[model samples]
Each structure stands twice: as C-alpha cells, then as structure tokens.
Target: MGKKRLKHRSLFLLGGQPGSGKTSLRSAIAEETQGNVIVIDNDTFKQQHPNFDELVKLYEKDVVKHITPYSNRMTEALINRLSDQGYNLVIEGTGRTTDVPIQTATMLQSKGYETKMYVMAVPKIESYLGTIERYETMYADDPMTARATSKQAHDIVVKNLPTNLETLHKTGLFSDIRLYDRKGTKLYSSIETPAISPKPTLERELNRKVLGKEIQPTLQRIEGKMVQNQHQGTPEFQAIHQKLESLQLPPPPSSNTPKIPGL
Candidate 1:
C-alpha cells in the first residue's frame, strides 16, 4: 500500500516585537507564496481606518485613541472569519507573551489546519531604536508623534519579548517552528517528529499571568470604550462586522472548546 499523504491548509504566525521586521517578512512570504496567503496584520486595520491619515496629520493623539481599540477587534474578527473560510493565513503581531499566538495556532489546528510559527529574535534595544528610525522615516511629516509612538512600543517590547520567545518554543502548538534573526536569516527550526506532549501546567500558568497582567486590563479598557463610542462607526469595524455577519458565526461554544483569545 502507498503511504497516505496528509494535506491541510496552512496558517503562518509571524511573531515579533514592533519594528522587529514582521511586516517585511510577511510581505516576503506572501510573495513567495504567490499571493495565496491572506494576511491578518494588526496594522492593516489601523491603516484602513477612515480618518487614519487625517488624524495622523491633525491630532496624532486621537489617532491612537480611536484606532487602537477598533483595529484590535477588527483583526480578531477577521482572523476568525477568514480561518473559517479555509483561507491560508499569514498573521503578523507582537506576540508579546506567546499566549496569543499559541492560542491562535491551537484554534486553527483544532479546525484541521497546519500551523507554523516564525519568531523574530531581534535585540530589544535594537528593535526599539529601529522602530524610532523606521517610523521617523515613514512618517517624516509627524516626527514628534512617530517618536512618541515608537517609544511607547519600545517599552512594551522590552518588557515582554524575552519571555515571549521562550514561551513560544515551549508551547508545541505549531507543527513547525523557526527562529529568525532581524535580517530574516533563519536561526533554528524544530525537528519534524511525532506528536509531542504538551506542558499544559506551564502554558496555563503563562496564560494566567499574561491575561491577568496584560490582556485583560487592555481588553477591559477597550471593551468599556467600545460600548461607549460603538467603535465610532469606523469603516474598519463595519467591514469586519459585515464579513462576520456574512459568515453567520454561531454563538459561543462551551468552556472546554478552544477559541482564540482577544489580544
């Protein structure tokens, strides 16, 4: 008898701190894949906001205030909708604490998708400096705002990035995982082998810490304001909502069922 060939859709989780070159790497992968990958990038939603350019020009502070919450929600909703549609995905994000990517990969795996994770291992200080330089160059018209945003992003990346890479390596959720340097050089790839046992206790503790410390507070703040502004009827949110409505996603599953956590 011939060997059975296993086939499944792919989900690539590109993990890195801000300015660590996730977007660039994602673009490269998309091109290599011949545009077959659907990107679920955090910044894409922000860029799609109706007033994004205008807000960046006039009141930079309001840009963050309005775009942050809506972008987060839209990204998550789009991931769910697209994954359900069986599109191959390339998701880019900070992966601040590893929980987000691990949870996301697990959800896709449960849906019979194959998962790969690429963790970018850039020095925290270098990433911070790079962010300032990149943003200053990209947003030359608003250097002050660019520097402020870069600095704020730097703090979060410095605080969470070290542990994130370590935790992600430990998750075992991905069928294949690779570490890459800032220049897109692959550092290490996990060996192809049989199913590995999960360190559930460690994962649970990490999830608890991440949720209690980072995610929950941020979600609470965003959810509270989302109730108030109703997303300010942002185009990004409206488009995602329309997609979700078209998908007709069912009501929440039971507690035991795995789902993607709000990042």
Candidate 2:
C-alpha cells in the first residue's frame, strides 16, 4: 500500500514586547520563505474605523469590551481565507489586548493543522509604563476623541507589560487581560496545541481509520467499488473511478478496507 502523503502547513504566532525584535524576525522569515510566511498585523484592519481616535481610547478604558470578541472572529475568518488561498499564515499581534491567538490555535488544531507560539523579546523593560504615561498626557483633554490611539497603546501594554499576567490575574486595572507570558527565552510561547482527540462520532472515527487518514474510511464500500473498476472498462466504474481519482486517494489492497480497532 502507498503511504499517506500529508501536506501540512503550520502557523507560528510571534508574540512579545514592542521592543522585542518580532517584526524584524518575522520579516526575515517571510523573506526567506518567500510566499510561504504570511504575517497578519492589526494595522491592516485598524484603518477601517471611521472615528479611529475615539475607538482607540475606548478600547483602552475597557469601555467597548465586546469589540474584542468580534476582532477574534474577524481574524479567524481572515486566517481561514488565507489558508484556503494556499499561503501558510504567521499571525503576529499584541496578545495583551485580546484572545485572538488562543482562538486561532484552537480552531486550526481542530482542523488537523499544526500551530506554534513564538516569544520575541527586547531589552526595554519599562517602556510600557512610559507608554501609558504618554497616552495620559497626550489624550488628557479629549475624553472621546483619543480612543483609537489609546486602544492601540493599550494593545501594546496588554501584550508587553512587565507585570506578570498569571500572577496579576484581573487585579483591579486588569480584568480581561491575557492569561500569561514570561517563562523563558525566545520561542518559549506558553501557548500549547491541545490534543486533537475529536469526540467519537462513530461514523467519522471509523471512516478516518479505515480510509487510512486520507480517504474516507467510511466510504470504503464506495472506494472499494471504485478501485475495483479503475482499470476494467465500464461507465459506472469509470464515473466512480473519476470521482475517486479526483480525490487522489492512495490505492488500497482490497475493496473492503479493514476498520481501525478503536473507532
């Protein structure tokens, strides 16, 4: 039997402090990989807000909290669309502001693709505090007008703060902050890909095991009938063979493929 050839594309999420050389490294990787590395940053969608200034501050103040969830959905859609178009994605963002990376990793892992986390860092330790200070004086006069920029700054803080998030977990100023960061050197992303143990839908489990990972094990009855007629000339077999050929499944030993034991 021919081995199952799996063409797997992985997504690596580069997350870290602003001063961290994430952008430079991401750019270098993308250039080296040519079209394979796709970096999606917030700057792409942020311009869409008509009153971007107000939105930025509101985002920082935690006033428009629901926007975070919507952003995650929008990102997922963008990643999905990009994957379908054949470019492997590298999602880069200030994770402090939202749960987009967790959501994306969960979604991609479920679909059988691999996802990884990257932690980039730079030498600046107190930059975030200074950033918050700048936002305070810069937007002091206009409560409603300074939101968009505030939100952007807030995102940077949320993702890059010196305070430990897991230990701080929602203490006063931090309610919906990121879960954790700060374990070790670069590439030590706390983010983990959960086990891909799909709930037993007797049908799917059975199909996957028998059809050998690539073919629909459940469709063995159909696949067997199709392969049996791949060479023998007949319209019904020809149609079946055509359908099977398009799927490009591996040739099997028998029409009635054996079932995987556990499924």
Q: Give the TM-score of candidate 1.
A: 0.61
Question: What are the runs in model 2 whose C-alpha is more than 4 Å off?
Answer: 1-6, 18-21, 50-73, 95-100, 124-126, 129-263
Per-residue lDDT of 1-263 in model 1, one digit per residue for the tens? 12121345788988766766676677556655667777777776776777678777777645666677878999889888877877788888676667688789889898788888766665554454345345434444454244234456556765666566556667667767666665667655665422332223223322332222322333333334433444535432343333333345554443333222221
Best-fitting candidate, scored by lDDT: 1
Q: Estimate each model's TM-score.
A: 0.61, 0.41
What lDDT tens digits, residue by residue, belong to model 2 across residues 133-210? 333333454443323234355345533333332322222222122112232322222323122111122112112222
lDDT of each: 0.59, 0.43
**Best of the candidates, TM-score:** 1
- Residue pairs clashing in model 1 are none
List candidate 1 stretches off by more than 4 Å: 1-7, 31-35, 51-59, 141-152, 192-263
